[model samples]
Target: MTFVIQLMSGLAVGCIYGLVAIGFSMIYRAMGLVNFAQADIMMIGAFLGYAILVAAPGIPFWLAIIGAMLGAALLGFVIERVAIRPSVARRADQVYLVLLTLGIGIVLSNGARLIWGADPVVYPTGLTHQTLTLAGYPLPAVYLYIAVVMPALLVGLHLFFTRTWLGLALRAAADDPDTAATMGVRPALATSVSFALASAIGAAAGVLYAPISYVSFDMGVIGVKAFAAAVVGTLGSIPGAVLGGFIIGLGETFGGQLIATEYQDSIAFAIMIGILLLKPTGLLSGARR
Candidate 1:
């Protein structure tokens, strides 16, 4: 029963990592660069949602989530236009772009600290103060919300990629920008759209996770674990991201259950390393199509 409870808890948190991994995968697919600030952007979303909850007490939680998503998406677009695109235009070294993202992460983290203070803030989950019982064990209702939200979001993303023209174009641009340009797919627009989508998804993850864990400026460190999940599942594969997330979640929980809590976090890295040694391209080989 305890194992089950821990597993459920891990799954709920893992879903957040998977969502962030999706952003990492999408941005990497389109731009060939990781937004080191991806996690910080999620922190921004948490604050935005918290602000909405405080400023407009009557506003629905769902509506506040939308506001956070929009804010994060706009921030992503601005970053792409102002920082990434200009550097790309100048044919800057990849190291410079990577450094730029790292710098942006620092700026955003410190800026958040300045505004919110260097303290963790508890978010009001608004979930019922109730627990569902299974096998004589109780689980928080918020777990159900995370479980439901993750699948729904993934399905929406799959539909966007497989059914929509713009989605297909974005995929094409990611696969081959020069070829996509000749085929009338605008690489610049696709890049901007990818960043926006990634940021929105990251924000959604933040809102979902903030309820489970306290929101703090330094919480973006989870982005590293999510990146491990991304690499474990296959960096550019959407389905892989989902698989990798659950694997990491389950592994950490199970490892902690059998071993020690102090080493729980290291389990994800061990799995990542073991998997990478066996499959360099990731467990899933093909990129998202």
Candidate 2:
């Protein structure tokens, strides 16, 4: 029962990582550059939901999450238009865009500090009272939600990528933007949509994560974990992200319990390093560039 509980808890965190990693993977495939500040954006959305709920106590929790997601999506769209687009146009240097994103993240985090205060605030679980009990082993309702949501999202994404025309356009842009353009597809538009999608996914993770771990300025590291998951699963593999996330999640849980908890962070990085060192490509074969 204890082991099941532990694995399930890890699954929740892993699912969040998987959800965020899908955006990271998809965007990278489309744009060839990593969104360095994705984690920070997620943190901002999480905080936005908390702020809304805290202020209007009348706003439903689910509504707050949707509002936060939309707000983050709009912010991403604006940032891409105002910052990324201009930088890409003026100079093709990748580092400039990378630095721009990092700066944007810093600005948002600091702004959040001012608005929400430096002190971290926890979002009410809204699911706090429920538990699934099996033979006296208690599981948080949030875990069940995360477990279901991740797979549902993955299936939806798979269908969107395979069955929808826009999804095909995104993939086409990812494969070859110039050729895609030759076919009348716009890569920049895809990039913008990718950013918005990434932001929304990150916001979702933040909402799902709020109850499990108190919302904090520091939660962006969860985004880093998702990045690692993306790396391990192979850059463009959605299933790989989910698989890698679960592996990391389970590893973090059992490794901490049986070994030194201080080494948990290192363990995850070590896995990433080991996978890259051994496979060089990633766990999935077709996911490489």
Candidate 3:
């Protein structure tokens, strides 16, 4: 029973990681740039949800998630237009673009500290503390929420990318911008939309994760592990990112249980390193790029 509960917990955390990793992969695929600020965008989303909850305590949690997503999406769009797009327009070097994103991340983290303060904040409701008894085992309600939300979210994404014209355009733009543009798809618009979508997903991850842990400006540091997951899963592969996330999450949880809690982070990194050594293309290398 304890093992089962631990497995659920790990899966929940892995889902969060996978969400953020998807953002990383999406941006990489569309813009060919790794937005280091993606996690800070997640932190900002958590704060947005926190703000919404505080302003209207009676609002549904799903509403708060939507509010956060919209808010973060707008921020992402502005960032792309104001900073990233201009650099890309100028044909900046990849190293410079990466450093710009790193700087943007620093600005975001510090800016969040100024706005939300340096102290961590928790959700105001009892939902975070809720639990459910399942087959004689107590399960965290947040874990169940994660289980439900992750799959639904994945389904939504699948439909969006497969069924919608905008989705098809985005994929075409990412795979080949000149060809997509020749087909009447604006690559710039697709890039902007991709960033917004990625930001919204990251925000959703932040809001879902905030209940399990406190929301702090530095919480963006968790992106480090998510980045490792992206790399392990194959940086440009969406399915690979998710698989890497679960691998890291499960490895960390079991390692903490069987070895030592202090080594959990190390265990996740070790697993990532081991997997990369054996399969450099990731577990889902053959999946969508």
Candidate 4:
């Protein structure tokens, strides 16, 4: 029962990393840019939902979640438009664009600190801590629901990329931006949509995480870890990000059992470095495509 609980908890948090990594991978593939503020976006999404809930008091939790996702999506699009696009247009160079994203990330995170204040905030999710008897052991209801959200989200993403025209266009842009542009798919629009999708995913993860982890300005650093997951999985592979997230999640979950809990945070990152050192291309060989 304890082992199962740890696994469930790890998977829940890992799902957040995986979801954030989606944006990390998407931006890297599309614009060749890495936004360091992805996790802070998640933090802000939770805060936005929290604000909505506080303002309207009667708003349903589900509705607040939807609002949070939309809010983050809008922010993503705005960031790409205001902070990234102009610099990109001015400079055709990749490193210049990368530096631009980094600057944007710093600005966004600091702005969030100013707006929300430096204190952590908690938003109740109404998920009860009551334990249910399962396999002759008690299991928390929160863990059960959380375990389902990740796989369900992954399936939804898989379908979107494979079935929908927008997703197909995005995938095409990720594969070859120059060719996608020639084929009547605007790479800029694709980048905008990618940011929006990634932001939505990040916010959705935030909504799920709010009940579990307290919201704070420093949450953006977690996005950095997610970036590592994206890199370790290869920057553009959706499936690979999920797999890498799970691997990192497992390392953190089981680290306490084998090693000390003090090293828990660094376990996944160490694995990421190892993967980078051994196979720079990552587990998925075709991410550049």
Among these predictions, the greatest lDDT belongs to 3
Model 2 ranges with Cα > 4 A deviation: 55-60, 128-130, 287-289
Ranking by lDDT: 3, 1, 2, 4
Residues 1-289, candidate 1, lDDT per residue (tens digit)?
A: 7867887888887898889888888898898897788888888888888888778876776787789999999999999999999999999998999899889888888988988889898765455345788678898766776777788888999899889999999988988999999999988988899889999999988888887777798888988888888889998777787778888878887887789978878998998999999999988886533
- lDDT (10s digit) by residue, model 4, range 1-289: 6788787777767777788887787777777777776777887787887887778876766687789989999999998888778878787587777776767667777887898888887765454345666677665564565566667777888899889999899888887889998999987888899888888888877777777767777777777777777777887777778777777777777886678877877887888988989999888866444
The worst-scoring run of ten residues by lDDT in candidate 1 lies at 122-131
Ranking 2 against 4 by lDDT, winner: 2
CA error at residue 134 for candidate 4, angstroms: 4.7
Residue 56 in candidate 3, Cα distance off native in Å: 0.5
Q: What is the C-alpha lDDT of each candidate?
A: 0.85, 0.79, 0.89, 0.77
Which window of 10 residues has the lowest lDDT sum in candidate 4? 124-133
Over 4 Å off, model 4: 128-141, 286-289
**Cα error, candidate 4, residue 92 (Å):** 5.0
lDDT of 3 by residue, 1-289 (tens): 8898898889888999999999999999997898899999999999999999999997888888899999999999998999999999999998999999899889999999999999999988666788888888787677776787788888998899999999999889999999999999987988799889889999999999999998999999989889888888988788878887888888899989999989988998999889889988777787656
Candidate 1 lDDT (Cα, 0 to 1): 0.85
Candidate 3: worst 10 consecutive residues by lDDT?
Answer: 280-289
